[model samples]
Target: MRVAVTMSAEHEDARYPYDFLRHNYIVYLQNLGFVPVLVPNGIQNPEDYLTSLGVEGLVLTGGGDVDPARYGQENTASNEISPMRDETEFRLMQCAVDRHFPVLAICRGMQFMNVFFGGSLIQDIPTQVNAALDHRTGTHSIHVLDSRIEQALGIRVWDVNTYHHQGVHTTTVAPGLDIFATTEDNIVEGILHPAYPIIGVQWHPERPSPSPEIDLQLIRSFLDKAFWK
Candidate 1:
């Protein structure tokens, strides 16, 4: 199956901005029989562009934080805001919603999905949430609350590597989305839209883990959804 994967915009040099995506994402997808196409930010009419690509599914990769202004909040703790990437992804998401395309969102991608669906985020977990788990690094246990994900993954309780500062909570999740998994501290770790083929996880399944099969299983489940539906 062909999948459109979003890339992160970087401005290391003021005169030479560029877009990049982790190569592992491509390898992971290819290994699972997917033709991974990297979608650059700042495209003209992104929805039309995605339609032209003839992709069956969309993959929102992890990157910089979503702009707080998107959710009617002032920039308090969020960093690396990419307005162009945000615009592109939002348009792509609209197209996905319109076409009922399956999506697998990771980390920042997950947070973006929340904000796209009229949800909010906890700008910074450590400063905002008291006694929060060290979400910046290390592995943490997540309780899978949804049977669909549990059945797809074949395990309910599993440790996933963490790599983000921003997150979502129960009170801040989008209306139509369900909190499928969460950490012990109650920080929202996974979300899914019941009416759509959309699954968002706060962790990066593209990265290596102690049990690599878990990540493979997760990707397999996403591919199965994307291919069969």
Candidate 2:
């Protein structure tokens, strides 16, 4: 299966710029026997082009902060913005929803998916929420909710790496979406559309880890969901 994976653009030089993806993403998908196609920054209607390329699913990879304005907020101690990439991803998600396309949104991709669906977010978790742990860089246990994801993985609790400054909570979630997993402090870690093949996680499954078997299983399950549903 061919999967469209989002990428981040690098400012290499003044004349020419380039878009690059993380190696782990390629390695993970290749190991699973899926072709990883890059959806670089600054593309209009990316889903249309991807569909033409026979892309079966999409992986919204992690990257810079999403513009708070996209979720009805002003500049609030966030990192740099990728307006073009945001637009491309938003459109791509819309197409995915329209076609019921399978999607795996990670980190910033998860946040963007929430905001795109009329949900709000905590711009900066450390500054905004009174949390004991540093979610920006650490590992934590997430309690899986009673949902399709839990049934697919058969895991009630799982430890995942964290590397984000923003997050969502249950009270701020969009209607009709299931909160799949949450940290001890109730910070949302994963979400899923109850009736669709779409899923999002606040961790990077492709990142190097001591044991990646479970992570690989998640990806495989997602692909199987896409293929069968």
Q: Which stretches of candidate 1 lie over 4 Å from their true place?
A: 226-229
Highest lDDT scorer: 1
> For candidate 2, which ten residues in a row score worst on lDDT?
9-18
Q: Which digits, one per residue and each the tens of the lDDT, describe model 1 over residues 129-178?
A: 88899999989999989877887777999889899999998889988898
Q: Write the per-residue lDDT of candidate 2 for residues 104-156, one digit (tens) a residue.
A: 99998888888888888888887777764578886888888755666777778
Q: What is the C-alpha RMSD of each candidate to the true structure, in Å?
A: 2.1, 2.5
On the 0 to 100 scale, the lDDT of residue 17 in model 2 is 69
What C-alpha lDDT values do all the predictions have? 0.87, 0.80
Candidate 2 — which residues are off by over 4 angstroms? 10-17, 226-229
